[model samples]
Target: MMNWNMTMKRNKLTVLIPPTPDNVNASEWWPVKSDVNWIETVYSDNKPAPSKLQGVDVFIGTDFTYEMAKFADKLKAILIPAAGYERIIADALPNGAVVANASHHEAPIAEWVMMVAVALDHKLLQSHKTFVTGLWDHWPGRYGPYRELFNRTFGIIGFGAIGRRVAKLAKAYDMEVIASGRSNNHSQIAQSLGVKYCWGKQGMKEVLSRSDFLLVATPLIPSTLNLIDEQALASMKKTSYLINPARGNIVNEYALYQALKEKKIAGAAIDTWYKYPTEETDQPRPSTHPFWELDNIIMTPHHSGGTDGTRNRRAQTVAENIDRLTSGQPLINVIDF
Candidate 1:
């Protein structure tokens, strides 16, 4: 292990940033005047050569495969510019190294959640498509009426950062918010936000059955993987809509496709998916299922939290952690496990 006293005296830390969408504008947001030596590099096939990691004091990228960890002899910290750190291989990290992640995505993701909720309830996409084709069937006078978010129940599967933000936003529209988490510990926070909180299987069922609009905001983990299955989907109201901006696999892909296809529920707005492009030029489909053919669903390329504000805030956090490391200070947002 490097001596903190000696490292602080030297006051020169090396930060390696790989070419990632999260780090594309890193230079613009990084501390312009600092002792830190920022080394910008590229990787092929998403794997940097082991030599590139040598002498790197900090790594500011998402993916830390076993291959990269084998050579991160000098790495003191792995700072994930984004909130999700599943790509990081914790078992392979060098001993004494700390892992941390930044999160400024709640605001933007909440905005997207509400936007799509309103769109789904009001059938905005359907109306727009019809009107552009010179069809008046969707006209208020002819199509009867559209739904509003007011007084409707908004259900949340996870009561974390994103869930709390969404609950606050949902209140703005005069919606009743109810949430279920892994435990009852978040009940106090939920109460402060004027949200009804529950936990366990019974709690989840209540949220699912009563919700007019459901939002999935949980992290993907062993317990949460495929948390929403066919049986869970069947519990929802027939008129309810589902919105997911978190990890994709949290909700079973096949079950979601089947529900939408059979009109089991009203509709869905999915921002995350099962498959993604492996290369820059690749245009692989987001899922094995034909979600594009479904008109009731709104599909996005997992960009709900990719706003400029999110990027800048995350970059600032990374820069702060690097500064903390060089100064022998404790890092922020450090993951315990």
Candidate 2:
């Protein structure tokens, strides 16, 4: 078992769970309540009152705004139920508080990535749309031959947990997997997975130019923002398809739109977006550009990894961490700013 210096003297820990869409019906999956030592409090709104947050030992939510932090006087840990911590204002967190995130989303997200890759390569959505409209242009004899994933080069940017999972799945399809990251730290692991890995600008160029299907799986950080700009997009093969299950800004929004409009690349599958619905506007456009006008793109509302399995596993992880906090054990997946 892991160990930590900090331990709660209280018999029970108050865990405040907000009513975010991701946290819907969380009581069904959270296992800690049965333990009797953990108290689970479900807030009615995404933004809870200061009174709701006071004395809370744990806050189980994704968005940790400054306002939430201002009232979190007794918070021990802010356990995000998901991997992405970009929404969290780490600077706003109170002293002695630790932030942690969970990652059971790799499998589901990899599945979505591969699914969309095959769909894009096969032109499945386009074909379906045309065929359903009584058009026979997509007929095997009428249309040009479709591409198969077999023996194709699958390039991945940011070879982290999700990228590793994607590489395994792509390899299962007999794809030639090649990946690049910020450093050579995961080089050996990539090699063991039969992936050709490299780093630096030259490595990125090699992956971009050679891939039949390229995947963006890196996190959104300062140096990584707009990593795939107009110049980077121009480096890709015109027939290659881009798959981004990562953040939207990682690929320039306007640049991506322009590329698709000009057929700079064959197509793209984008899950994350530049714009999202806020409290005032529940249905704002996902981007400043009209990507929906393009036929060679596949878009989803950032839910590729929001699977039931991910929810259950994350809930278990949060429960385990809370249990560890009460038991004076070191937590897993702790994030340091």
Candidate 3:
């Protein structure tokens, strides 16, 4: 039997690639060396054992655990092919191993944010249903008043890559952009993006009170978990809209349902959810609350960042990072542990 703890040199590097979409030939974007050994695996919680993961030098997957990490003695780098790495524990990795995250998701997710914001603002679902059923001409009062995207205040809770992208798009629509973040000082970056930046509790209230459309783009962290609770929801203008393309738990699920049920806020565009399907065949309810029954909100199956452009861009980023790693160049998008 091979000694799992014994570190091995990469005469022929082993690259582990996860299953890609049917149409996407991953080789086109993530090209590898001729001598490299490739390992293919199904992405799931029931992963292969440490013995099976022995010689992995580069792992390109979304999920990793401490149990699996312990066996990766020869691992040089772990590359997350997706934007979010909240679940990844930095301390779990082997000594000297580096981790990097990819983000071509920003552009597509930003577009989704803007699309749903406009759709909800105009009450598109209600209007379309009313129009299709021929209720518009008969009952104009049934459909609520619509709003425009122009000259409105667009607020973002987290000012990361996705938030900045959303800000840029919002600015293109001539909307006033305001952002609040966990960072003590994002003033310069915010100002450069032509957005007013705020921080901490008091600043959050200021942004919430004035925003016409509020977006939650923060990552899931200890401090950010349930960041948008009842108090936060109450602080917002009753006429404002909420758009969440970030993690589901970032907002208090129950409070959001209560707020929407009572019409406290105008409406919301939610692309992320509290619950998700575990398998390809399994269909799970997104929430305990029947958000689907609500007319004021728009719900999507957490697919905001899923686009062909996004996939290709992400693949390119991963490929470039791999090249950078081989050339001993400082890698881009290195996660600050």
Better of 1 and 2 by TM-score: 1
Reference-based lDDT, each prediction: 0.88, 0.86, 0.82
lDDT of 1 by residue, 199-304 (tens): 9989999999999999999987778889999999999999999999999999999999999999999999999999987666989999999999998999999999
lDDT of 1 at 303: 98
The best-first sequence of candidates by TM-score reads: 1, 2, 3
> Model 2, 1-337: lDDT tens per residue?
1222222234367778754355545445566642322344454334556566777878887767777777788898988888888877888888889889998999999999999998998889989999999999888899979889999999999999999999999999999999998889999999999999989889999999999999999988778899999999999999999999899999999999999999999999999999877564478889999999999999999999999899889989988887788767899999978
Model 3, 1-337: lDDT tens per residue? 2542232233446777766567755565575432356676675643444555688887887666888887787888878778878767777888887788888899889999999988887767777787798777424465444569999999999898899999999999999999998765778989999999999887788888999999999988888899999999998899999999999999999999999999999899999899877566778899999999888899999899999888778777777777777656787888887
TM-score for predicted model 3 compared with the true structure: 0.89
Every candidate's CA RMSD: 3.1, 4.0, 4.5
User: What ranges in model 1 sit over 4 Å off?
Assistant: 1-9, 19-27, 44-47
Which segments of model 2 are wrong by more than 4 Å?
1-9, 19-28, 33-51, 279-281
Backbone clashes under 3 angstroms, per model:
0, 1, 0
Clashing pairs in 1: none
